[model samples]
Target: MTDSALAPIDALLRTHIAEYPGFPTPGVLFRDITPLLRDAAALRTVIQHWKTLIPEGIEYIVGTEARGFVLGAPLAYEIGAGFIPVRKAGKLPGNPAGLSYDLEYGSARIEIPENSLPAGARTLVVDDLLATGGTAAATLELVRRFDVEVLGATFLIELAGLAGRDQLPGVPLTAVWTIQD
Candidate 1:
């Protein structure tokens, strides 16, 4: 949970990041991570960093849609836990539980396959970034619907100034690198 253990992966993130001002809207600085996703070393570093931060008794890694599946799948593999996809509404093939919430720029809904995780299963939520806590909070709500215990939540990088953590009150949240903006 400390920055000390996160140092090894900092260089990789910095190398692959790009920032754009006023993206998707005015007065918004968009941080793109496609560069990191395209690099083997950077991806490996992300999985490695997450492997060490997983909370004890975590039986599953619940990844938020899109980017979360990108890194969370691999991290779950390395950590010997199962990966549960919390995808966008209508993306999954079966009956799924859904949650709607606001985004940094818009509103959206997310879902998880019904009965994907057993009742009381301990889980850790992972994602590439933490900008607004809405997605993560919604994911946690989905987890609760399945009756899973959230061991903790982890992110590769956190946009710290957004107060994303405040929305997910009482959860043990950790990010490898936090950018205050």
Candidate 2:
């Protein structure tokens, strides 16, 4: 990504990403991106950064549930890729392929639409944040069930020092903003 792309976006993120201490539990600092999402230019810069990182021939963009849906759908559209959803179990209509996994806080499951892609289709997995890699790993496994090759996993933010990337071995992961703990 260009220095022009990184500077402005990182500045906006540093300024607007809210920190909630003792969230979901004590000793936790939650970096909320709601303000970044609300800023059109910052949001655009985020996608623009992804545009530079995303390799060509990505047939589909697979987004993790909740926040990923916010960024992934738009990124897929901007990059001319089909959007595939990876959601929380029981949240999807009809039967889907699901995988249960552990998160930094607790256990959770993620599911993808059955037969979403043909074998070997290049897909990029996306989410808003990577905290412990549980959800991202689960989503990656679910996506592989469809026999597609996951090009990479991308995130809007990465909580450094958590080592979430350890859970996702052999997979390329990119995060636009990184906060060291």
Candidate 3:
């Protein structure tokens, strides 16, 4: 859907996110989606809207560790696609392919289980938030290791002030809501 078409859902989503000032660190504002997840109506609305945003024929949804799992899994089920979980280092069992990257706040590593997808499967990377795009970019890199076709990426919210999109060139990115932070 176009930005204008998604305005209603985006407006409703804004109300679902809780804002915290100076959380997890000083001088950092946190937008929490716990409230969104707790509300059945809101969650359903988001999932339905995402269905329209996601491309047709996506073979799998690659969710980033943690929040992405919450959103991606259901969306995958809704769209009849498989779900792949990308995790932080050491979180995956067995021999997983790993990649290290820098975050806006610090540095971290992400990993995906090796041979998780059949070669040439198409996928969409998903997460709850897009900040500096470090994690998303790293997750995309990890997804590439599987020799799959990355269709695009989607997020629940985007901190536009951070310009995370710049970190992900040549990839179609969609966010349910965008706010300056």
Candidate 4:
């Protein structure tokens, strides 16, 4: 789709994003995107927007496990890039590279297959949201173990006030929306 076609998509996201206060904890407001995902047109717009940012030589898209899968799979197909999952520890079979980090509520580890991509392969990381940057940062570290060149990290939304970008120094980031908390 053309750039002009994406305007409606941006508008749809602003209209549909639902906000919940004290979600999963007190003093925390969550920008719920399920409403936007439920709208077919909005979802298509987001995928198309993401497709435009994928670098030309990207061989793989490393998507964080779970929610990231929702965006990454369709995006992989859209751009003809291979999809690799950065899963929680023990969720993957065979040997994988693991990295540990803390989340808003707890600490955890994420992993990816050691040989998922060839050495020096270019990759793009995708996820639904960027909050504290822990998950994305850990995933980036895991990808580096394979000696791959990370193209960038992309997200549907970024919580600007959380300072997630600070954790991701030197890496490019792209997001459709930015919300200051």
True-structure RMSD, every candidate: 1.6, 1.6, 1.4, 2.5
- Tens digits of per-residue lDDT, candidate 3, 31-142, equal 8889999999989988998888878999999999899999999999999999999988998789999999998677999988888988899999999999889999999988
Cα lDDT tens digits, model 4, 1-181, are 4557657766778898888999978977877878877988878878887788657777899899887988888888899899998898899788888988898878999988877988899899999889999898998888888888998999888888899999999999987777776
Q: List the residue pairs that clash in candidate 4.
A: none
C-alpha lDDT of candidate 2 relative to the true structure:
0.85
- Model 3's TM-score against the true structure: 0.95
Best model per TM-score: 3
How far is 166's C-alpha from truth in model 3 (Å)?
0.5
- Candidate 4 lDDT (Cα, 0 to 1): 0.85
| lDDT (0 to 1) per candidate | 0.85, 0.85, 0.90, 0.85
Ranking by lDDT: 3, 2, 4, 1
Using lDDT, give the best candidate's number: 3
Per-residue accuracy of model 2 over 1-181 as CA lDDT, tens digit each? 6768578768878987899999988887887879888988878877877777777889899988788898999899999999988888898778888899887777898887777888999999989889888888888888888888888999988987889899999998888887777
Model 2: lDDT of residue 145: 85
Candidate 2 runs further than 4 Å off? 1-5
Model 1 earns a TM-score of 0.92
In model 3, how many backbone clashes occur? 0
Candidate 3 ranges with C-alpha deviation above 4 Å: 1-4
